[model samples]
Target: MPNQNDSDSNIHALLIGIDNYSSTSLFKSLEGAVRDINLVEAFLKNTLKLPTERIRRLIAPNREDTVLLVARSAHEPEPTYENIVKAFTELTEAAQPGEQIYIHYSGHGGRATTIYSDLKGEGQSDEGIVPMDIGQPDGRYLRDVELATLLKRMTDKGLVVTVILDSCHSGGTTRGDYAIRSSGETDTAIRPRESLVGSREELINNWRSLTEGIHRTAWIPVSRDYVVLAACRPTESAYEYSVNGKERHGALTYWMLDTLNTLPGTLTYKALHDRVGAKIQSKFPSQLPMLLGEGDRAIFGTNRISTHYTVTVLQVNASQQRVKLNAGLANGLDSGTRFAIFPFNTADFANKQKQVAIVEVTDIEASSATARVLAEVEGGIGVKGQIEPGAPALLLAAPTDLVRRVRFHDQKQLGEAENELPTQALVDQQKEALDAVRQALAGNGWVMEVQPGEEGHYQVALGKNGEYEICIGMPIKNLNPPLMFRDAAAPREVVQRLVHLTKYQSVQELDNPASELMDALEFILLDQNKQPFPNPSNITLKHGTKAYLRVKNTASQALNVAVLDLEPTWQISQIPLRGNNAAFYELAPQETADIPLRFTAPEGAAYQQAKEMLKLFATRGAADFRWLRLPPLDHVIEKQHEATRGIQSAFGKLLEAVGTEPNAAPVMTRAAVYEPDPNADWVTKQIQVTIVPESLLPD
Candidate 1:
């Protein structure tokens, strides 16, 4: 066994194992409960090195046949509801903040239900654990909700607790049944008709689950503190099997202790879970152990990663913009660590959260590090007027309007003779076309001028894209025909769409970080408590509670932020501003916009829309969606094409009326560029968040 080596530590454990039940009860005897408990005790006492005195045991009464009898001392609590509750109460009173604790349960687990008709939103009777003496009404089963209530007390006291359950409820085990396939979860327990060892002449049995009434729903507590290791999903039953030369034990319990003994204090909760789960599934193939809990916690109270520490407020060098953290090397941290600051005091694990700013460690001492802010998440439109209703940010006059300067690249010369006038007249005609296109765009707020690479932030480039007209249907077919935008694709709109697509794709290639211009900006989604999901791609929701979207701005300039989401059904919609106020955000420099993302719907309807992929676009200036008033992307592109064609036609007739070559070849303009912002540039990023269904949540 690996040694933990920590002799002086404030850690406590409660280990419960019950192998016996009243003969009158519906449950059968189990052969592995005592074995599982004994092995776990060895793991804590011999391997992890917790003192035997700190380990509390609630086991079945001792008998001569027990194989691990030598491991237990004479003085120990017997498995009883009163004793178990008493241990919890005492721990609640004695445990302190930052104290570590372990809770393990190995025993008969059968589903039971208790009526609470008065409770609101209570759908059915709750699932429970079958306790010893469950045959009597006075010895009620320990229910899931009741257990959650008990666990809540420990969490409320701020003690870090880890729970391991190697048993299943909804009682039926098949250890002694006719041979069957072990491909998936099935009951495997020691259930025999009861017969007294001495005086009882007849073996009789009454099922506990049969009398208790099985419930369709299990009421596990909603908590974030207790790290959990459940034996199997609620849909499946846990099993006890013989392995390693006739050794009998609960599958999960055996694998768990084996891993802990091997890795000891060095294994993390996550790492331990992965190794244990893999072993259980590989050997049993039918059973799957589950790991549920907090982020990056280490096993046996060692090497804890503290992500919750506060920033040191002192600014030793204001010009350098350096800061420090409250924690340092002593807190398992070192230099070069990056920290994200949340504007709010709390974090919600289920909401779409935003980040305020990013800071990196520059120098480290024994307890703290010096950090400098790299960039601010800022998007300000610089519009002074009061914002109209439902728009999150004010719309300033566009940057292109402000710069009134554009660089026009005419690639039309690359096209065929039919695309231009006769060769003799083509030079003058092409020059005239360039002038005409340039003047048309300038009339729409672009002045054909740029200082080398500056380009005034917006450039008008056009060319004949025969590909646009050749052998292709609409690129966006999902849009309704009314919004299909069937007209010729405009030079400005087509160019703008291509530019937007390029920028959007750049941010998505996260592996190539350099391709992103606004890599420093982050939009976070969080649960109600302001804690992020362990897996952002697979978010778990709690009863349709509200989620939050936090924006972290580290840049020095303001910005306009717009978040668009694609539903699981492929519908595209923008995440509206708080209270339908604005379409975009005019965020201040080095500021954060923390808004509760309440999708405008009835309470029930919101939870149904949890599966989504969100695209958050941040621009140096506002990109107004209100003017577009478009539907999904499929329709948006089509309509933009239609509008571009309209503008081109108007410009084409104007060129003819304004006196060009008296009679010239028809101009085949292939593309258009929309000058979205003349004053500023924009960047885009997208992330997928999948909210797991409530029915599937273990707790």
Candidate 2:
């Protein structure tokens, strides 16, 4: 959208093709020369819709032009070095302003080396194409000066000409810096490389003398108006490929036509070359295309008159917004392709707010498809990677439907043992946790479903948090049930605090203009006035700035939650607070906890950047999930860490909890009685914080 087109109106083309050359200097004949010209000519006539008389060709066997019905003029000459030059001069002289000229050459080409002469100059000799009817040792060297001079003359007439040479060329332009090695070499450039009869240095000088107003040392063709698209880089070979059974094509020519015809709209010359180059690399990995002269010129003097979207809005509703898009299974735009509605018309792209409304496609039709507007806010959040949720990631297997919802369940505890917690008490704790989380994440198009008593697409489990294999969160997962039921202020305050936190989360929307913040923690940033910041991409704060972090639980069940700080060096330690009583806290279901952050945004060269990470983890049942290898419960004394225990320690005296034993006997471990559960759902996510760049800071 940030570009424009500048190309001519009228077109004039001179195409040359040679399958067989008479000179021994040509070395070998090409099988696809004529075929390549035929395909290229057809494309110009059909796809470009160019008039036939404006396009002329000179090929071997002296045949009449089939693409143009008009008979050839007496002035039209054969594709000899002399005739090619004459036709080129005529076009340049006659072409008026706003006209485009095309010169396409497909035939024998080679690097000229003077092996027969005793005078050996530098090995750096340029390449040339072999013209017909030359039997002498000198043959016909189509020097770069002739091409460069005529091209300059053409452009002087205010004509935008493009030259596509499908023949061999050496010591020209390069694709640059990328490392590439010759996969292998093939002498398929119509003509084979061979030494000539004269000295290389003298031949280059003689050709340079014919061109005026151009300065260069090398014998390579140079042009500014005549944008040149060479077959390959200076070091590579251009190949002819056999498609299907027998029909052949010059690989570069085939892809060039294929891309131009398939792309829906006109592109700048640079864009077209990029597409063609990519296609050529896919088919022949080693062959790199060369681009010389102007890259920003419009392709064939055509422009996309107006902006177009493959899909358009059809209808809008409270529940969902429907869109009609031409992209389908064939176009390869599958479900989940996001659509956006900007605050202002796209024509004023710079003035519009980024993504005022966003949607994810849910269904497809034959030619058009439908998508659901997932979330919408006034100013809206920037698309994924900025503030919005990115595409969902599925691990292990793909979901049945592309769009999936959240599912919740309390962790299933299997056996019985130790001084266990009551089933009712634990279940009540989990219910409270789930209720809190459910309220916090209310309006972001989240679809919540009760866990299937069986396996399904639902992710994010509510079991004791930090189960090692999944995600970990805050503390208070394991405590005496008596404390929760007590009248103490600390115990009652936890519930009230959770309720207030949920209120904040419930009202939070991504579009609020005041929201802009980042801190190394899984929490929301609230300013001194207690309003949420906008844009989580970067955070800025000065000396007196007051900020608060609201860390919320992801699961429905209560878990022992711990907040630890991870330094840039990967060392882990608890984030010490002056008033917090314990190393970890009992995080109630969906409870939102607050941590006040105090610091100044680093300034000047002394300390330009600073980063800190707070990791939240929760584990149910156990005093500590032994596998974590963290320090002992910091609030308690007697300190050697304990061994990992099983479900016996997690569940109390409810034998019916496992099953109503029909034998009236508690379920016992038996090798034959295998109640096998292969997998369970859990969740994990990452949060990052970055400092605003100095240049982007507020004035």
lDDT by residue (376-469, candidate 2, tens digit) is 4345542322211111111111112332344444453432432223454554455454444455434322233435574333332233221211
571 Cα displacement, candidate 1 (Å):
21
Model 1, which residues run further than 4 Å from truth? Answer: 1-8, 61-64, 68-74, 120-123, 176-219, 302-612, 615-699
| TM value for model 1 | 0.42
TM per candidate comes to 0.42, 0.38
lDDT string, candidate 1, 212-273, tens digits: 21211122532335567777655556777786657668887887776665442344454455
lDDT per model, in order?
Answer: 0.46, 0.43
Shift of residue 414 alpha carbon in model 2, Å: 59
Tell me, what's the RMSD of every candidate? 25.6, 24.4
Where does candidate 2 have its weakest 10-residue lDDT segment?
Answer: 650-659
Candidate 2 lDDT (Cα, 0 to 1):
0.43
Highest TM-score among the candidates is held by which one?
1
Report the CA-based lDDT of candidate 1 relative to the real structure. Answer: 0.46
